[model samples]
Target: MSAATLVGSEAPLAQTHDVALVDLDGVAYQGHLPIDHAASSLGAARDGGMRLVFVTNNASREPEDVAAQLSGLDIPTSPDEVMTAAQACAALLATRLEPGAKVLVVGGKGLVTAVERAGFVVVRSADDAPDAVAQGFSPDLGWGDLAEAAYAVAGGAWHVASNRDLSLPTARGFAPGNGSLVAAVVSATGVEPDSAGKPSPTMYRMAVDRLDARRPLVIGDRLDTDLAGARSGGYPGLHVLTGVSSARDAVLAPPGLRPSYLGADLRALLEPHPAPQRADGGWWRCGDRAARVVGDGLEVDRQGPQGIDVVRAACAAAWAAADAGSGPAPQGVADLSA
Candidate 1:
């Protein structure tokens, strides 16, 4: 469905969609920490007959490790239920390269495992006369690693990157992700690597195919990656506020970047979503709140306790204004507090 025709679900989203292609880091857990209500909400969705697939751009860990980590967080998961960018990268490589082709790896064990599983021989240095180069993210990556990848790519080896996420969230803070390291190789060889992750429809399409899901909902925290990927793959996206994106971001989203649904957290999956309707005097009403685009700003009129409904109405008003060529809504236009 097109962004303009996007509407809220009258039924619980968990009952409407057969599968959920969920982003791991921000929507489920942040770094090693479990997000509030994530596990319980996910479990409830599972009980409601929705299959959950954890998707990640992090190529440092194997599926088993990722599943184990989720289990540790009290969210029971299996390797088959997880899809990594490394797997997507390897799957793409398999279609281009011949069987048993040697590929120079520049990341961690996860990348190596994915390549090997795809019937490609994993090599280390450029001296191996590699058929291609594959890169991903790893905590132990060093300057020496980027040099080898650059050398291989410069020597005519095809290059493929697991993902292009610029920054990764960690317990300490944001750190350089695979995309940052991939930039180094690009600078050295003046060549770009093919990516097989989010924002590129490949990973989402792969997950949908593997799950055999007729109806899938992509749930994520990042608009650029997860939600953008969902739009590219023709799937509805549910944006969560527990991670990087805020209500302000959603209200200001441009076409093709807007999510079909918005959630404060995973628990929104269990609740029916009310559609925002146009009211008199340029006002948009959603549930207990009404918002209007006044000049270049938004004004929210709450009829009940302040909640996500206010954000929904504000987004409707802002998007409507933008579509009418009224320009972007003013920043800090909505009273976000409860």
Candidate 2:
């Protein structure tokens, strides 16, 4: 069935106001190459009087490095506006540890520096068991290092992980993330760590604190990390099918991973004075267009690009209808199993 038919009974809370837009990327730039759509969406977010932050789960790089990456992407972002799980892990440790606390940081210099910046004494594997081992993402982790991490955790140090992403997307493909390292420790020491990445309240708390956000909306490409995170934090999430998520995957999200709003890209929400259309047997207005569902899917003949923008219009209409308590027939979009 169509997306509208999926949202059968329960009405989705509608948001007609500005929303906080967060970009999940290590850097907006890669050497001389700029991240596609980074500049435009970020610029649009700023112009719309919306809060914008780059929330990256890549704990391999420090905030400064992330800033430099944005500089490369030609996306202008301040250091304060950048939030990394590496930084969040550090902050969590600092608040709970004593001054001069010994930390066994596994991962990269980013985690090390963040821990040190948080007033914790940094320790490596060569040193004695530290007070904690902050596991962050490291691409070149050695097998021996996994043993070392196990030893650190078994030695009675607190285990903290930057993120639990089993794999991270790269220019090549999916690679192991910091969660892989944390898994080693868990397997060896029988200990699970406190995570500071997506889907964790710790990461959300850090982001909300940094942005001073109130009634903020989570925007992410992944349902597990982004939508689950928002649900865990009791906030609404906007799922944009622009990154790793496929249309089929989105149609089959688990209950906890469902997004309040679904769209194809960032432009659907960031554009100023967009159009409205009739879609999914309903009407939606964004900027100047109306979207309605004509069949199993949305039908938008508006004067703009087809894709995520069109999907956004349809989603907006559905959301509006839901809020008005007169939206589509609820069929649990999560059951689509695309």
Candidate 3:
């Protein structure tokens, strides 16, 4: 189907877009647990002829493993429908390194296999004198693993991180993610790593090109990584309030981090997005709901349909204010999400 060039549309995204580049963790599931509406919502999007591509920053798991987990959660995903940061990292390394260059993989099986598949020789330690160091997250990684990565990177090896997500969501709470561990290596080596994950736009563009998506909507919960990547790649993004970011975050987002559309959850794919329009008196309106920024605070007036309209109006109003040299203060944004 030929997709329209429109970003925020009156028609359902399922009908307008050919592909949905979905973020897995907070959008589809929270760790090992399934989301309440995610399975059915994504299934409906698929049935409506939108191809689903599950994009993840987690370099620990393989596509097949992630697919199996989503399938078990009733999402009915295939390995081909999944894209991981591990694969993206490998691709990034391939562009810089020779065909058989040695990469000291300081990650789990997924990252190691991805580097090997990209025609790089995978090594274990700095003692191997590898050409590069690929760092990612693994639950079993001990002090030895960090030391090895630090040693290799300090020895003039190119350091590459799969994703710079500072925290990982688990069933219990947030823990150290790949970025946290990468920081340890950075502390020792005094070197920064080139990432091939979200916020880079490399992974997003790679997924779009691989999937051959003409109109791909980058959907995620984070404003920094997902929406920022979409902005850089010239793709429209739909931000859902399902994970780390909240409705208030969208309102105060800078130009690069702002999403094209806002949704409460995955089911937003099935609905129309009515963008907030500029109204009189420095306000933005979406379906009768209105919002505006007053000094450092934000005001929401004229209530409308519950969930999404408020976010839309708030974002438009706040964005306008910020662009004009006035943004919202933290004290005022707390109630939008609540």
* Better candidate number, 1 or 3, judged by lDDT: 1
The total of clashing pairs for model 2 equals 30
- Name every residue pair that clashes in candidate 1: none
Q: Model 1, poorest ten-residue lDDT window? A: 329-338
Position 249, candidate 3: lDDT: 79
For candidate 2, the TM-score is 0.74
Which tens-of-lDDT digit does each residue in 1-338 have in candidate 2? Answer: 12322221122212233346464632243224554565786676566577666777778787787777675666777777778888888887876789798988778878888888888888878357588888887767788777777888888888888888887666666666777777877988899888888887566667777667776767787777877787788766666665666554554345566676665555535533233444343565544444653334443446654444444455555454544555344442221111
Listed per candidate, the RMSD to the true structure in angstroms reads 1.7, 6.9, 2.6
Tens-place lDDT per residue, model 3, 95-145, is 899989999998888898899999999989899999999988999898999
Better of 2 and 3 by TM-score: 3
**Residue-wise lDDT of candidate 1 within 99-209, one digit each (tens)?**
899999888898899999999999989999999999999989999998999989999999999999999877777788899999999999999889988887787888899
Ranking by TM-score: 3, 1, 2
Segments in model 2 whose C-alpha atoms lie over 4 Å from true places: 1-21, 26-35, 271-338
TM-score of 3: 0.96
lDDT of 1 at 282: 92
